[model samples]
Target: MTVDRGVDVRDDSGFTLMELLVAMMLIGGVLLGLAAVQTSALVTTAQTRQRTLGTAVTNQVMEELRALPWNTLNKGLHASFASAAGGDPNVDGARLRPPVEPMIDEVLVTSTTQATDKAPLSGSGGTNVTATSNPEAPGIVFTSRSYVTRPAAGGESLALTVITTWRANQTADERHVLMRSTAYAPSGGCGDPNNQPYLGACQALFSASAGGTAPQTTITAAFGGETTDPEVDATTPILPGTDITVATMRGGQTGVGVTAQQSTAVESSALHAAGSLTAAGAPSASASTGGEAVENQASNDVGSEGAAPTDPSPVTSNGVAGSLAIDGGDLRMVITPGSGSQAKVSASTVTKCTAALPAGVPCAASDLASAVASTTTLSVGATNLQLVRVASSSITGWGARFAGVAGVAATGCSTVSGPGCVAAGASRSVGAVQLGSASWSGGAASSGLIQVTSYSDSTRVERGLSQRTAAPVTARSGSLRYWNGSAYTTVSITGSTSVTASTGTVTWTGGGYTVRATGQVAVTPVTDLASAPDPAGCTGEGCSISTETGTVSLSVHYRVEGPSGVSAFVTTTTLGAARAAAGFKAAPGA
Candidate 1:
């Protein structure tokens, strides 16, 4: 034992008055280790949350760029396109406008004032400056810089890249994420022919190849941008935004517009109501997307959350109180490169391969080649879709007005009750007078245009105000019973819903939502009623269909999976008719 400062200490490691200080040092060291571990966890969590937000912001910026008229992305925004001298001088030397959203994340320390650097290139050979953004933030600001790659010498596409940077709070290191996208211009630029928004098809989804045998190596999941490793095909970036907007004007004319372009793609301005489309003056010119190195194919979905049940909605009026309004004007689908000598698709005898076509009816084809390889094809006008699908507890208004047979009222207005009368999903759907429901022949090839517009059974009906539920209680599923006069009958709508008495099961036997649109129990599958196939008025190659119309009011939702990548557009306009019976539901509280 050793004596030190009046206390006897046992071993050198043991504690005495002086040695006690050493023991305290050991505890302090352990605590420091623990604090370091805790700090690491907090840092990791913060980064993960910020990364998620950055990803969403990155995708949104790219989508906004794509949504604009394709031309603006090059000349209007980049300043390096169509100047004939390679780039515009007055503008910021061809660099893309950097994306900034103060509301999204931490505000940049130097927001109004910014520092400049050649936007970071995810790949090689990038040497352009003039674009500006906040590379540093006071706390955790996410600043993004963008760059646009004009199409290669024979290419018409425009590549967009966004690099989002954020400085980590713990470490002074700056973290970044890169995202990209591509877009095409519309056809028939009678106004700005050379400066059209899209030089190629707006929805091509591929990347430049490295002279390789296997091309999937450099493909992405959406319209072409930066080509990521194709092996991670499951991680394809999803382009965000609604589909395109097409509306018919007063003089039986239709137009589509993208506000970002600062111009209108008003197609079919002059359809020659008096005579032939080729007669005197028909706005001629269609953007032909024949050249494109299409991307790879994959088994993919747009992030499926399982199908949400269609909410209850009303089918409104066609504004025709009594007139047939059936003197349907002629809508010629003029395919620019069509064989004029051959019968126009509007007058062709093509097989009713409704199944293979947009219509889901099954048909057999004899000449698969002539059948698949048609003279005409579907243009952007025909392929755009406008959809709004959501499941909510709050609903207002109705789609169609229903009355009781033999003076009976449609008792379908019980909002929050038990299992509904109709089948599992929606069994009844009422639509306004539609001009685009035709059989397989080109005469009126209309189906699949408005594939699903339905509402479920368990919904209640209220006129002035929407109903509110205090809490969500499993949203009662399964068959139920309703009062059908004399005896309590398993609920059933005369033509739509039916129940098996022995088993409490409701089933939908009706032809689909669009079938019973107006006429009693009418289910002629809609192929292309509002729009036609070839705008130059030919039977579309059936690759897609255009929604042509003399006059009607409705919302359109168009989405397509092209070359493994997904792109969508949406437009809502009141046609010559009143507002569509589109129902709105207030989402439930968490």
Candidate 2:
């Protein structure tokens, strides 16, 4: 059939023109390597979400400078990153950032600027590097750097550093993002052994010494670390004549040292008088009589003899007469002149009597001679009667008498009581006197009486008296002193006494004395030290930097960038397309 058909060629079915231009250049080179691997996976997912939002904004600014207050941690970097219209340094998007300005670029590193690593983030070198502008991602851009170190001597701890740099679209080939971290400020706390600042914590030093002797005393605590031996809580021991008060440890939470107060002393005894007796003048008597009465001879003149007595007598003769009569049972009588003559006497149981005798010696002849033989003799005519002259008596009978002034011839009698008789005109008896057996011859008398002898005297006395008083004491809490050798002088208590802290003792009883107290410990000084900012390229040539006293070094740096369109590129890269040298060329053409 048409064998000649073999010469008719058939191969025009699609793709020619140089195979469609190499299939549109291999599908536009695999869509430009998938749009450069999706813009390098959106720039590596916006650089891993801006490095996790700049490490969460630098761990929230190192937990807000570790909650500040370790003497304010060098106070720096805040205040909205130091002005650029100040306010809004990422405003609440990354939270935690509020120390408001002290040093957005403070730096004071030492040890040769931390041995350099291009060290000028701000450690006294230069170049602060602030650049902030995020306000929660509006075009992103941030840079902050801080460094501080120079404390570590007695080592309380210090060393902080932070550096952050970021860039997202302000493209000058934009591609910077760095964030280094180091944090520590007021870490763990507690220090200030008097380095002159940072006041708080570390106290325990009390002291006392009143131990010269009485009640014994000595207290000491002193705390530097280890020496334990202090505990005298509700105390006691200052009694003998006491007044005690002790208090120092104040409130709670431990750490109490230096606070003191003390007191004690008082004493008394003396008063007495008693003994007595007194007496003077003892013993008494009284008696009286006169004369006349001699007419008793009427019994017929008792056997005769009447008118022969006219010389000075009314004797009418018959027997004993006139005188000697002690009645009331001291019986002693002898009065006879006839008609009723009497006789009854006795008073001499003689016990060695003597009050003077010998003048005619016959007042009963020596101790009343048995009271004249117990009298009773009467021989009238022969005059043999008895009882002869006796006187000196505190009255027993016939104590006072007088008569015989007619013919005047009786005299005598006077040894004690007298105002009358003793001769002179005669016949008189003053007080006690007795004479018996008639014998006054020309005076006609037989006895008289006058006597008084009594006496007594006594005395004794003793005395002593006193008055003046005050003694009262009490002590609580405590603070009373009188040591006065070098110090301590204040003691005044009486009656209501008071002191409060709990613990008491105070006794008084006149005055016996005792007191000495010394318990001292109270110290608190460090005046707080949070003011150290103003130094970061100061300008007047004084960026302040001279610190060393232990613990306080902080450095912080943070950076973030990722807002320029929230970034979106996954991946991309490609190259390779030149060849032509292996084939010949074509030029001429006529």
Candidate 3:
């Protein structure tokens, strides 16, 4: 019997049961959407990572394969590095994908020779093995193998392909990446010196005369290779060219000089010739792009003849030994450096810089022909030894190493190259250097066949009628002068006739005088070679590594034989890392 209020009051505080249920459903739905988005993002990130890894693995391995020797590009005897392939990286410096390379672990490597995507011409099928890639891609695995297209008849051009395959844990689809290249066998796979990759320094070398006092010279460019002996036919011409005509030696039957002590030694060359010597200035080096290969050019060289220092313990043999001239000479195993045309050194022993270097840096191997006389410290000393890479893919340098006076304070240290170093001796510097096409050949029982050639465009002697008397008396009986690296050599001429000299042919007609000089070494391809004479070696497993030195040479050319697209020359790779594995594997890629 409470007093009746104006109206009955009611409280509507919280939400209704149905309202709460609807709100809870909305919140749960929002949370679920956020979780789904996060999951999708994570998956996308993982896929991206896998793609990136696959690309890296493909590229790195492709690069490694690209460095293989031309003949070494063939399929392996087995699907493993345990056995020697056609050519081995350790022996021939054929850089296939390194088994220990990062990101991808190879259980086995195989090569297949197929005209199409089918199996190999003759071989056991390739062994399948799971790949273990980087931990970053724990769920993915990669596998790789090489593909070589069967050469066309009479056209030994080979198409090379390095294919890499991969699959992820959750996906049914597999991805692939491939790298490809073409290789040509110059002489039916006998061997090609010019087709080699410069394993050390990318450069060309030529012999030069160290003329004058202590044979002072400044190198503007250089080339390097290993020297081995291989006997050749002594009576026939070894090479053909406009200037080369005869053989250097007239003794020794085929394969007569190969010795049991055949050993390989590093060959180092400074300049093509004294004529190629140029004073140091701004180096004119180059690097590679997508299409172009890498290169280097040196300049502003200053040097002089001097003694070898003791502290750095310079390399005494196979380099600028006292009186060994570093003149850029006109000689080479092949016309091209590394287009599978020729190979002087086994592997690309050196890889040069990405950009053009200044006056004082080293170049890369991709563009360089090679490096020689590699030593613990002497050839690559911190301050004493200075190397300059040339655009022609070689090295040009000057050494100021000089022995210290017995009692005086480094008497002979003054030179054009620079000053002396700590715990060093007196030295002399090279003042100038020149760059040009050049090469050199080693002498011995294992030397390869080479023809001495005389170049004419600028290296020899050639001039248009621009300076001669227009319609005047012919150059008949006119005197001629030519630069022989150190000085101008005057030569006698016969009137309106060609005179054959012991070394060359000199002609003087109504046109200017032409002096052609040539020399040659008649070498036979040795069957008892240290390395395999052919890429397919005797057993097709691989050539037995020579316990002695490996002898190799350039292909033989016969100028006297005439050009029928036929040559008597064959080349072989002889030296590099030589290793053996415990197990033997035999099978061509299928």
Candidate 4:
């Protein structure tokens, strides 16, 4: 028995220690493989669930936007719904609520692939932990952000973009899921219920009067009458010089008409009275009562009473004999009597008569001779007739003449610096002259300056004559000529001058005379409408919104758990989606 017992004692009973260890190792490997497979399956299932949840959340947000009114689509997120409600579906009233956060699960269950055993995972995964359950473990998170955009091309429809984003898992390296969707809200229903095939209500256009009353008026179509079909061509012909009449649609519509008229013609003329003549032909009547009787005549007259003398020959009256004749369109009186003891012929002896007495006044021979012999200068302000040495006993009478100072030569000084000449630095007054209505040629008299450039010194007061007997002078182009105490010269302008048909006053400056005239300006009436129709739906006459058309957009992103770590998904809708959601099938390219 001792022979085989030695071998059967160990090898025959069971495996050795090394064999047991090898079997144990094989079993451990199989169990480890099963664990790995189980973990992979769990990851796949979680990721799938996450994707479905993300899609559902995104769609939910888009559906919510589709439910809103087209007008309020751009009201923005977080807008209060309580304020926006109860209004016409076509109108953008305050009754619509803005996009609000939807009630849904924003987080996914924790994934088993998290690095740390802690509930929600720490470090990189900590920030996404939204759930309190198992906060120390890895978990998927979902976040949503929404916004709206208006297209550069404006339209009635709005695009709502909903964006949903989430982490695939609680790991730092996990991918994120993003989802986006859009819907549109558009103006629906007829804007005007009373109008058939309604495009919109007929807007009443009217202009108001000052008294707030509407006047019946005719109005022509600017382009043409309104048309329902856009493809159809419509035109309204407006006849030349014809106005269109507007039919009465409602009460209180009024119109107004205006007219404007302006006239600017200036005419000037002069009247003559007995007076003393200055070197420049300006006359100054004296206050004396002793002088030959003279008759007042109309301006530019060559005879008595502005009529041509019937007798062209000489005629005598009283001791003073004279005759009237025309010379170069001028009237002249001639005395045939010779200068002798009978009468005195001298400028100093000449006297201005206060009254008109066709009969001549008698003068003693001795008195006349004494007046002629003395070389006395005439009074500056005295109104005396210029006496020519035609006869000693009798004298010829000459009428006063008026000449336009504008564009005439000065009589006396040839240059601007001399005695009896206008001073170059002194201001002087010009005699008043009457201007006719035909002087100006434009609207209200334009304020300007009148320049005179000539000078002379002669006492011959001739009617319709501008030149004097003294030296002739002219003013410089830019120099203003004025009369000083003894002479005329250029002076600097110091003040404004006023000119009118009746009177004119001026200040001298630069070698020329400038006269400013003022005329009445015409004013026109303006017509406008008190109120206008609103683009957006109107409660009365005002608009509820500043703009009637706009756009809206929404965005969404989604995240979910995946096999590796985390997975991300994203989607975005186009403008076409907005049109489709708005039920606008007729829109182009929708």
In terms of TM-score, the best-performing candidate is 3
Candidate 1 has an lDDT of 0.25
Stretches off by above 4 angstroms in model 3 are: 1-11, 74-132, 151-156, 170-173, 184-590
Write one digit per residue (lDDT tens) for candidate 3, span 1-590. Answer: 68865877799799989999999999999999999999999988987887787777766655554555553544432333324223332122233343333332222223544112122211233322224388998757876555444433425455555556677765567666655566554442232423552222111110111000111112111111113222334222223221221211000000000001011011112211111111222122111111111111221112323421111211211111111111112222211111111111111112211122111211111111222211110011111111111111122111111112111122111222111110111011111111111121121111111221210000000001111111111111223332233333344333222322211211111112111212111112211122332333122332222111111111211111122222233221111111111101111120
**Per-model RMSD to reference:** 32.7, 60.1, 29.7, 43.3
Q: What is each predicted model's overall lDDT from 0 to 1?
A: 0.25, 0.23, 0.25, 0.22
The digit string of per-residue lDDT tens for model 1 on 1-590 reads: 98667777676554577778888989999999999999999878877877776776677656554554433444422222223223422223333333332222211111111122212221122222213223322356665554555534424455666666666666777676777666544353223433444453221111100000000001112322224422223322222221111111111111111000111110000110011111111123112211111111111122444421122111111110110010111211211110101101010012221122211111111100001111111122223111111111111111111111110122221332211111000011121111212231222213312221222212212110111111111111222222222223323222133222221111111121111111111111111121213323211221111111112122332233333233332222221210110111111110
Off by over 4 Å in 1: 1-15, 74-138, 151-154, 168-171, 185-590
The lDDT-based order of candidates, best leading, equals 3, 1, 2, 4
- For model 2 the TM-score comes to 0.18
Clashes of 2: 69
As a TM-score, model 1 comes out at 0.25
Tens-digit per-residue lDDT, 345-429, candidate 2? 1111111011332221111100000111111222222233332221211101100111111111111222222111111010111
The model with the greatest lDDT is 3
Cα-based lDDT at residue 204, candidate 1: 10
Give the alpha carbon lDDT tens digit for every residue of 180-275 in model 4. Answer: 333343343334322222232122211100001100111121321124312211122111111211111111101111010111011111111111
